[model samples]
Target: MSDLGNTFMRRFVQFINTADEKLGEELIAPNAEFYVPFQSEPLVGPRGWLKAVEVMRGGFPDVQWTLEELVVEGEKIAARYTMRGTHEGTFFGVPATGKKIAIQTMNFYAMANGKIVGERGQPDLLGLMQQIGAVPAPS
Candidate 1:
């Protein structure tokens, strides 16, 4: 199961880096749920996951996530990543600053039958905003 989880996560990273819908569909279950920050409703399925990726790409077209660490237990996996990109476009209503950003993110995934069925993610959004000059940094 650990090996399967690792392989699944590797493919997931590839899907996110490329934003390939077909690969996403193959990796994620049809009824998968993703709970994201600041959103009341959970995003569902591959399309929903891709929409989130699109939102990130809207700000950082070259954004990429690197899996730094992974831990698997039963049907669940916890992953830590370093997300890097340039602020080349609008993001969350904030204008582009042409700055580069590298932030950490932690995500947990639940898988069943070799497909991801659920995910809960925590990203360093405040750090990203600060790096992009959208928010003030602490003294």
Candidate 2:
């Protein structure tokens, strides 16, 4: 992993945890594409990406993501992470339950000119729902 890639990864994690859309705007390219497994269409550009973050934060005001592992190679980075939050607002049609949830996630990113140009994330939605009592756990 090049130093630049490593630095980007670290900065990305910090920016996400901070929930600062302004700072996030600077880290992404104008035409960046962000993909989430459950979304029908990829989010376009920094504005679109920030909107998604805002929605997530609206539901989990104190949400935090912990980067467990990151590997970068030739401008492509892969990360494994866990997101923790308290269910304080509506999310995906599920109302607040005042429960704390932690879900695992994996993401891949493409970078160029020190900005993120592409991203794809797979998150544990079922696990998250179960933790928040939106879905029942198996007996």
Candidate 3:
């Protein structure tokens, strides 16, 4: 059942890194729901998913995604991934820091019909800001 979730993640990685919207279409359902903190809108389709990733990559041109752990059960999958990138373009009003940053992220994905049905994106925002020198570390 959830084996589809694992397959989806594999295809997602290739789609995101390559900016291949066509392949992305095959990885997400027509009405997939995506929840991300960075964006106010819940992405609704593959086109939206592709656009969102493009914006993220534009902000962090050297972004790299590293999957550290993965778990699957029935129709759900949980993945922990590390992201490393340089701030090369403006992001949500923050001027480019030109600093390399790493953020630890976890995602829960639900799959149906070999495509993602639901996606929840979570990341360590505080750690990322601190690593990028955007904020001071806790004393």
Candidate 4:
């Protein structure tokens, strides 16, 4: 992968795991859009991206996002990652369970002008919920 791809990957993961809104503004395009599973509507621009991070941080204050693999194809980047944290606050109406959760996530980021223009993510929501006791484990 090119340096641009690797660099953006680090910055993007840092922005999400740390709730760095400032970094979001720098790395994401002004009109960028993100299709994320957790939200009903698509996230627009850096501010909208930050909002999603805020919601996540509110529930997992110490969340850590680690990139396990990355592949770059022209202006698109595909990444496989993992997030680990303890549920310490309410999340989408679910109360804290003080459970440690590890969820796998995959993402495809589209870049333009050295900024992220769009992103689509798929995360292991079922596993995450089960870890936090929101969803029951299989029998």
Best-fitting candidate, scored by TM-score: 1
Each prediction's total of clashing residue pairs, residues at least 3 apart in sequence or on different chains, is 0, 0, 1, 0
Per-residue error (Å), model 3, residue 30: 1.4
Q: For residue 120, what is the lDDT in candidate 1?
A: 96
TM-score of 3: 0.89
Which ranking of candidates, highest lDDT first? 1, 4, 2, 3
lDDT of 3 by residue, 31-83 (tens): 99988887887888887777768777877887878777889887788989898
Cα lDDT tens digits for candidate 2, 62-81: 98888888888888999999
RMSD of each: 0.9, 1.5, 1.8, 1.3
Question: Candidate 3: where are CA atoms >4 Å away?
Answer: 1-7
lDDT of each: 0.93, 0.85, 0.80, 0.88
Which is the better candidate, 1 or 2, if ranked by lDDT? 1
Q: Which stretches of candidate 1 lie over 4 Å from their true place?
A: none
Q: Compared with the true structure, what per-residue lDDT tens digits does model 4 show for residues 1-139?
A: 5787898889888888777778988899989999988777889999888877777788989888899999999998999999898899998678999999899999888999889999898989889888898889999
- Candidate 2 has an lDDT of 0.85
Candidate 2 least-lDDT 10 residues: 1-10
Candidate 1, residues 58-82, lDDT tens digits: the string is: 9999999999999999989999999
